[model samples]
Target: MPDAYSNIHLIVRWLHVIAGITWIGHLYFFNFVNVPLQGSLDDATKKAVNPQLMPRALWWFRWGAMITLLAGLTLFVLTYFYTPGAGFGATSLLMDADGITDRAMWILFGMLLGIIMWFNVWFVIWPIQKKLLTGKVPADQVPAARKKALLASRINTFLSGPMLFGMLAPAHYGTMSFGALLLALGLGVLAIWFSIKSSSRVGKPA
Candidate 1:
């Protein structure tokens, strides 16, 4: 029933979802589980745990992000660029329209957030992490590097839910009004911020 392009889209979408799950799963683990655990550790324990644990986790986290981004981009091109009749093809990033459709606006927003998150992971998080993993970071710089990575990771976690909703909402719910879109974005950001703040406080001593 599906054409070759349709079949390919299906496969790429599947890969995108799987890779995204792996990437975000590890992301949440780092922000929620490992960060708190590390906070509770003494210097000696952190020195012991990080050397063994962080490299392995980083490997999965970085590659998962790469795969997800690639696959998602491919799917976006196929669905939007190639198949302009699709709901997402209503607007171009370079072109200004009098009004944009709900589906197009949501997809564009999601893609923009995804791009920023990917950039943070690769350009920001991974580079700082590599310095730490290789011990090339100066003793004085370690805290700054760790904080940079943690903040970026927390920001990605904050963006993930809204990004996912933006990607899926058009297909599942058709289209949302502009007001509804704003409300969704606002609530999503607020909820994620609260979640990150709450999780960060875990494992802290009174």
Candidate 2:
């Protein structure tokens, strides 16, 4: 049987995978389906849909993000704290030391992406969505909230590609270069900042 820590880590990883599926799956649905549907829906349908369905979906979406982050952090801690000879800062090779030399860079990228995703869900998506859900913002204001939500969601999607790429890359390709890591880091940060700008509402209606 696995030790207590190992068992805990395994559970966390399982939960992470489950939560990530829910979160990213809904994210894709929102971007690819919901946004387009909004354009096609009549105002009455939109008003009905946004208040009822959208809020519940957003609740699941945000909570899934929270659980994913928690599970990821738990897994990271388990790896860093208990795993023998494992250096959190230095190189990491959990299984295939010979094949997966890029493990460190991949881990770093995944961690960064997780942070950005968590922030987007909690700080950006949830807040604006709450305003729309409550009566704080009128139906007229939903457009602005939606614009903000969509951009943030799309930003999450954009980061998702590279983040998943980096996460799984080590298993396929060798370690990435310092230049490549820096490029990924820069791109991730830019994606996050640009997303914030897209959703900014200082002077906007909602």
Candidate 3:
């Protein structure tokens, strides 16, 4: 039978996936759909629409990020420290005298990206979004604020591909060449581009 730790990890992993979907979905919506939509709107329309629209979306986006980060960290700890017994034990892989294994390296790499994304969500994107929503940013500063938030969100968007690969690849990624890794990373970014482009074509000629 799977150990309790494994069982718990599975549950948290599931939660992490669900929360991640929510987080990334809204992120894509913001970058792919909302930004362009916002651009076309008159000042009055934006005033009418954005206040109602962004808050509800941001509610999901920010909290989805929070839950995903928490669950992912929990899942990482359980996997990293305790996984040594059934998998390559953390003692051998992470705490050993020589160095860590590729799997551990990948997991840590993914976790780093996730932490950065989470930080961006809380500290950068959300703060600017709040200001814009509440009209706190000065008129001259509004463009810069929007740019900062967009840059942060786009960074998260691009990183997501590699982050997801890092999380999943370690299972089967044993000793893979760095070239292939780089290739996969490129594909991840391209996938983001493709998805965002596809979003524009999806239904609603209105």
TM-score of each: 0.84, 0.73, 0.86
Candidate 2 stretches greater than 4 Å from native: 84-101, 138-142, 170-174, 178-206
Clashes by residue pair, model 1: none
Q: Give the runs in model 3 whose Cα sits over 4 Å from its true position.
A: 1-3, 83-98, 197-206
Ranking 1 against 2 by TM-score, winner:
1
Give the RMSD in angstroms, all C-alphas superposed, for model 1. 4.0
Query: Which residue segments of model 1 deviate by more than 4 Å?
Result: 83-100, 200-206
Report the C-alpha lDDT of model 1 over 40-157, residue by residue, as the tens digit: 7898988888899988999999999999999988877776566534544523532336455566667777888888999999999999999888989999988888888888998898
Model 3 CA lDDT for position 156: 93
- Give a tens-digit lDDT track for model 2, residues 75-138: 7666544454443432245444564446655766787887897899899988988886776777
lDDT (0 to 1) per candidate: 0.81, 0.72, 0.83
Assess candidate 1 and give its TM-score to the true structure.
0.84
Tens digits of lDDT, candidate 3, 1-206: 89776688789999999999999899988888887677678989987888899999999999999999999887777766666346544645455565777777777777888899999999999999999988899999988998889999989999998888887877767554687579668988999888767766665466
In model 3, which range of ten residues has the least summed lDDT?
84-93
- TM-score preference between candidates 1 and 3, better one: 3
Which is the leading candidate under lDDT? 3
